[model samples]
Target: MGVVLAGGAGSRVGGADKGLLPLNGRPLVEHVVARLRPQCDRLLIVANRGLDDYADHAPAVHDETEGHAGPLAGLVAAFGFLACNRQALPRWLLTVPVDCPDPPRDLALRLHAALAADATACCAFARRTGKPQPLFAMYRVDDDPVEWRASARDALHEHGSAWRWHAALEAIGVGFDAPGDAFHNLNTPSDVDEYERAHAAS
Candidate 1:
């Protein structure tokens, strides 16, 4: 299933629901759904509050099971939901952040390609600077559910957060040159303005 991690409170955007934020007159989550729909047979939205808004757009809604637990919480929930629904677990889960409305147009296709080339490792988008964009990657859901739950508990103890998903994955970086600046996110009012200007020009 394709997953959009929309659980954050978006404190950076004046406490606005970033997923519901407008992008080219459509909800940012809609842009995400459009890009990801072609990639999976099912789509899941992982959110904290405002799950109804996401559910309005997605086929399924999986909230952070542990509450305010962060992205890893969302990941764990997605895995659990899938395990309960599908007879066999899927090989991978495609994840993207809610705020990034202009993620790579070919994100899903490229991630699948990367995974096919290297079955042992997962894939993540990387900027030219070589930093992994953790939220915009695909993860191999191979671990035991109990083990993942334990990891989530441990992460909550040490960092007061859920599992460190990026640190756990065997990540292969997918690099881009002249990476689309449109991927710049709407964190604040100024960022929204900048994105609007850039988006208008495109």
Candidate 2:
């Protein structure tokens, strides 16, 4: 299953929903779904507001955790949703932030391949320019149900970020050297300006 994590409140962008922001005359969520659709058998979105709008692109989901627990909390909800929906669950869950409009074409393929080849790894993420992009990754299903949920809850309370959870899973990081910087995201106003300027120049 492919999950586009749009549950964030986009606090850094002045509390506006990042996925609904305009990019090239279309909602950014639309752009993200377009790119990820081809990579998975099923596409689902995770958004906190404007559920109907997001559902127009793909089925939308919500984070079960309280108090804006962030992306890790969103993933926990996604996993729980999948747990109840056994028939639609995929062996691996591919997640990308809704704000990233230009992910690499082979993003899912690379992460899936990396996790498959590594026996001990439960997650495989993108690493580029010597930096790790953990959220844009593929996670293999945890066979142990009880521990999985607990681990997620613990991570949400403890680190407040996905980094610790990624480490706990023994994740594998796949490297990329593409010049296009496919993982570029519109997380802030400056990012939007930089991307627009770059696009206009090109």
Candidate 3:
């Protein structure tokens, strides 16, 4: 299973919905979907707003909790959905933020390979510039998803949106400098413009 995290306050982006921002004349979510869809057997969209627009690209899903929680809330939503739909429970879940328009093509495969190689690893996450990208990661779904719900719930309660997902999952984060541009995200209107200009030059 693959999930796109489009639920965010976009605080740095002047409240603009990052996923809906246009890139190369298409929505940023469209670019993300093109990057991830080929790598997963199933795909889902997690967003707090713009459901109708996102639904046009994939099955739109929303967070279970209110207040536009964060990436953790999106995970809770994905896990809860998996719990209700038992058929996908056995599959691992790959997550990427919708703002990331240029994620690596083999992201899912790389994370899966990493997890398979390290049995003790609960999950595998990617990093760039020596910083962990928690939302760009994958997790094993062999266990009950209710545990994830509880984890997010506890984090939200104790931390009040200050909790980072890498801490929540105790993730085995991996950092690499992939060739060219990867992990480029659209967080601001200027970012969108920058991406367009750079991509056009390329």
What's model 2's lDDT at 126? 89
lDDT by residue (1-202, candidate 2, tens digit) is 7889998878999998899888777888999899888998898887778889889999988787665668887787787777777765578889999988888889889898898788778888888887888889888875543345567778888887787688777888899876664877787988887887888799
Best by TM-score: 2
Q: Give the runs in model 3 whose Cα sits over 4 Å from its true position.
A: 160-165
Q: Write the per-residue lDDT of candidate 1 for residues 23-91, one digit (tens) a residue.
A: 778888998888778777778898877777888889556664554567766766776677566566666
Candidate 1 Cα deviation (angstroms), residue 166: 2.6
- Weakest ten-residue segment in model 2 by summed lDDT: 142-151
- List TM-score per model, in order: 0.82, 0.92, 0.91
How many clashes does each candidate structure show, in the order listed?
A: 0, 0, 0
The whole-model C-alpha lDDT of candidate 3 against the native structure comes to 0.82
Candidate 3 lDDT by residue in tens digits, 104-135: 98898888988998887778899778777777
The window of 10 residues in a row where model 3 has the poorest summed lDDT is: 160-169
TM-score, candidate 3, is 0.91
Q: Global lDDT for candidate 1?
A: 0.70
